[model samples]
Target: MEISNMDPPTRAGAVETTPLLEGDGKRSVQAVDVVPMKFRDMPVAAESIRKAFEDDPLMEYFDAADTAPFPVSRRKLIDMVDWMGAMHQERMLTVEGGMSLMKYGPPGNQTNLPSVAFLRDSLGRLRPEECAKRWKEFGAKARELVSAAFGEKVADMMEIQVLATDPDAQGRGYASALVKYVLRQGDADGRDVWLLTTSAYGFYEHFGFVTVRSGKVGEDNPAWDGEPITLRIMHRTARASLAQASSEPKSPVMYTV
Candidate 1:
C-alpha cells in the first residue's frame, strides 16, 4: 500500500517498508510503511488495538463482569484504549496492520506521566466497576513483577507497553516489522528493552527477548472460569550502538533485554 499522508506526520525520514503477504504466504505486490504515530491517528489506531485485543485472555478477564450489550462494551473498550493511546501517542509507532506503544523511563522518560491512581480512576469511569478493580490488581502485580525482574535498571529501560495487530491482518509480518523497528531504536540508544506478555512467547523469542520471570494472574476470580493467564516478563539486553557495531568485526550476538 502506498504511504498515506491522510494518517498523520511521522518522524522525519524514518519510514521503513515491508511487504504485505497473501493467503498463500507469498509476498503481495503491495507494501506498507511502519511510521511513528501522531495524535491524529488516535481514533483509527485505538480501534485497531481494541479489535486486536478483543478476545485476549487478560482483556476478557477485565470485561468478564460486564453485562452491557456487545456494542456498548466494544465502544467502552475502544474509549479506554483511546485514552491510553492519547496519553502516550508520542511514544507510539504504527503500520497498516499493527501498532506498538512504548515508554522510556529515567534519562529519556516523558515528563508528567499519569499516576496509577489517576489511570485507575479513568478506567473506572470507562469500564465496569468490577473490570476497573481487576485492572487495578493486575496492574499492581505487573509492576511488582517488572520491578523484581529488572531492579533499578527497570527505570532506565525502553518498555514495549502495548503491541497489537488487527485479527484480520495477522501473519502478514506487520508485528515483526514493528518489533524490529523498536529493536533498532534500542540498539541505536544502547538501551535495554522489555515487555510483559501473556502470549506470543515464541514470537518475541525470535527477536531476542528472554523470559526473566513468569506469573499467573486472575486466579480464582469470580468472573473468570478459564485457567489463570500466564504472564511472562521478557527482557532484551541492549546491543552495541549502531556506530560501534559498524566499526567492530561482525559476530553473532543474541540480543536480550
Candidate 2:
C-alpha cells in the first residue's frame, strides 16, 4: 500500500495519536484516514499509485520502455489515473492523503467503452509509443483471461484495481481499510468482488478472497517483453458468508483527513 499518514512519533515531545484497530490476534498498526477520491485528489492519487506499483512486475514491464528520469513518469501516471478515476468515481475510488485505490462496480454496471477515448488520448499524449502499444495490446487479453478463469456468472463482480499506501504509512491499516470498505459494500449488496494481484496474494487472503487462477504472461503477450510476470485472479463471494462471520468484531472505520 502507498503512504498516507505516518506513524505517530515515538520520540520525546510527540503528540498522542489514536490507535486504529483492535480485535482478536490481528496485526496491530496505526490507522490512516480514507475517503472517496475527489477531482481535487487526482494528482496525489496518481502519484501514490505510481509509487505503489513501482516494484510490481507488470507495472515495471509496462514502464520498461520509459525514458523518464524516474523509474516511472509521474505525468503519465496522473493522466492515466485521471482517465480511470473519472470512470469509477466515488463508488470504487478511495484515498488517504498519500494512499489511494481504484476499483470498479459489478460487471455490466457500466460500460468501459466510453472511457477508451480518454485512455487513448491520455496515453497518446503522455506515454511512450512502446508503452502505449503494450497497454492497449495487453488490456483485452487480460480481460479475456479473467473471464475464462471465473466464468461469466461469477466474473461479473467488482474489481480492486490499484491499492497503494505510501511507504511511510506502511504497517498502518490503510490498505486493509480500503479493501474492507469495498468488500463490505459488496457483501451488503450481495455481489461478489474480484481482484488481480502479483505478489500480494497472501495479503488479500486475509480478507477472505480465494484464488481462482494464477499464471504467467505468455511469451506472445505484449507485456511479456523479456520480463517474467505473473498474476492471481481472486474472488470474495457476497456477504452471506461474510455476514455469518460478522459475529467476529469489525475493523474500525478509517477516517477522512
Best by lDDT: 1
lDDT by residue (tens digit), candidate 1, 62-103: 667655457344654544444353356456567762343222
**Model 1 residue 173 distance off true place after TM-score fit, in angstroms:** 1.8
Q: How far is each candidate from the true structure, as Cα RMSD in Å?
A: 9.2, 10.7
TM-score of each: 0.70, 0.70
lDDT of each: 0.56, 0.54
lDDT of 2 by residue, 95-116 (tens): 5643555444454443333455
**TM-score winner:** 2
Assess the local accuracy of residue 45 in candidate 2 as a C-alpha lDDT between 0 and 100: 57
Candidate 1 matches the true fold with a TM-score of 0.70
What is candidate 2's TM-score against the reference? 0.70
